[model samples]
Target: MKYILFIIITLTAIFSFSQDKEKEALLAAKKANNYVYEGNNLINEDDFVSAEKEYRKAISEQGTTVAGIYNLGNSYIKKGSYEEALYRLDQAAKIATSKVEKHKAYHNIGNVLMENKKCKEAVEAYKNALRNDPSDEETRYNLGLAKICAEQQKDKEDDKKDDKDKDKKDDKKDQEKKEGDDKKDQDQKDKGDQDKKEGDDKKDDKGKPKDEKNDKGKGDEKEKQQPPQPRPGQMSPQQVKSLLEAMNNQEQKVQEKVNAEKQKGYKIKTEKDW
Candidate 1:
């Protein structure tokens, strides 16, 4: 009987504790909802800074409050804090228990992505929004716009790439042509140098041709081995012969005169003897 009484007392204590926890949860949820309501009022007045504070207070009061997180994300969007807004909105979407809440979060995410020029990602976000609520005409319109923007961006990127490729090809051609011209110039220079070297090899140190100089030396040696030749401005052999003949004629005339004188003396002596 004592054991049964103790069991009853334990059951009573457990039930009281459970009820107390439920009451506390209810009070916290009520406080969080009040803060969310205040935040909404501040947002309506365009006091986003105050609204952000209230939303943060609501989240602090009840961490699992979807309205508080979603409102805070909207406040960030109003404040132009897109990265923060995306973070909070993504969190809200992940924890939201209703399709309507998910659609709102996804639709806002698409808007933020569009503002950032992420058209492709925005298209996907809008698509997800429509998946949750296919009746939303706004999401459908945004999706169409995102598709067009994404295509335009792709075309712009393709044009830029084509221009870059063309530039690369032109540069390559120019470089190749320059290299070919340089090689041709070098070859001509090398040929000119070779021709000059060959020309120099055929010449003597005195700038005369080697073969002509050698022939002149051989002629001098041959002249030295032969008879002596008359120098310039000397008498010729014919002039010497004419002078000898004249001398012989004069000697004959002198002899004839001496003989005639001797004959005259002999005749005179014979006459005396008679």
Candidate 2:
């Protein structure tokens, strides 16, 4: 009988402990819900700072409170803190226990991505939202807009690439043309210098052309073979002839005197002959 009483006492202690734990859990859940309700009222009043505090309190009271996380994310969106909003919304979506909760979180995540100009990611996010709640017309509409934005962004990038390519091609052509012009100018300058050097080689000391000087020498030889022409400072051919005749007469007189001296020397020879 004492053993049975001991067993009953042990069972009662265990049940009491279990019941106490259940009551504590219920109390915490009630506190968490109260904080979430207070945060909602603050959000409606446009008091985001106070609402954020209340939401944080709800999350601290009950770590599994989806409403606390989701509302906190929405508050971040209102504050334009998109990165924070995305983080909280993503957490809420992962921990969501229902499709309705998941749809709300994904839809807001799409909104944040769209605000940040992430159209491609936003389109995927909206698509996920629709997967959870196919009846949501708003998510479908946002998905369409995101698709259009993504295409426009892609086309803009393509146009920029094309413009860059065209600019590069034009630059290359300009550089080639500049190089060709430089080469042509150098060639013309070199040719001009070569022609000048050849011209200098064909000249004489007197600055006269060598070919003209040679032709002048040939003309001088031809003049020597032709009859002489009289000039103002020179004797004529007729005067030269007169001067030669005078010289001949003087020589003949001298020869006659020499013969007279020979006849005088011959008198002695005639007497010897008699």
Superposing all C-alpha atoms, what RMSD in Å does each candidate have to the true structure? 16.6, 15.6
What digit string (tens of lDDT, one per residue) describes model 2 on residues 110-215?
9999999999899999999999999999999999999999999889999999999999999999999999999999999999999999998888888767887679
Clashing pairs in 1: none
In candidate 2, which residue ranges exceed 4 Å CA deviation?
1-26, 192-274
Clashing pairs in 2: none
- What's the lDDT for all of these models? 0.92, 0.94
- C-alpha lDDT (0 to 100) for residue 2 of candidate 1: 100
Per-residue alpha-carbon lDDT of candidate 1 for residues 23-106, written as tens digits (9 for 90 to 100): 999999999999999999999999998999999999999998999999999899989999999999999989999999999999
TM-scores of the candidates in the order shown? 0.71, 0.64
The alpha-carbon lDDT assigned to residue 31 of candidate 2 equals: 93
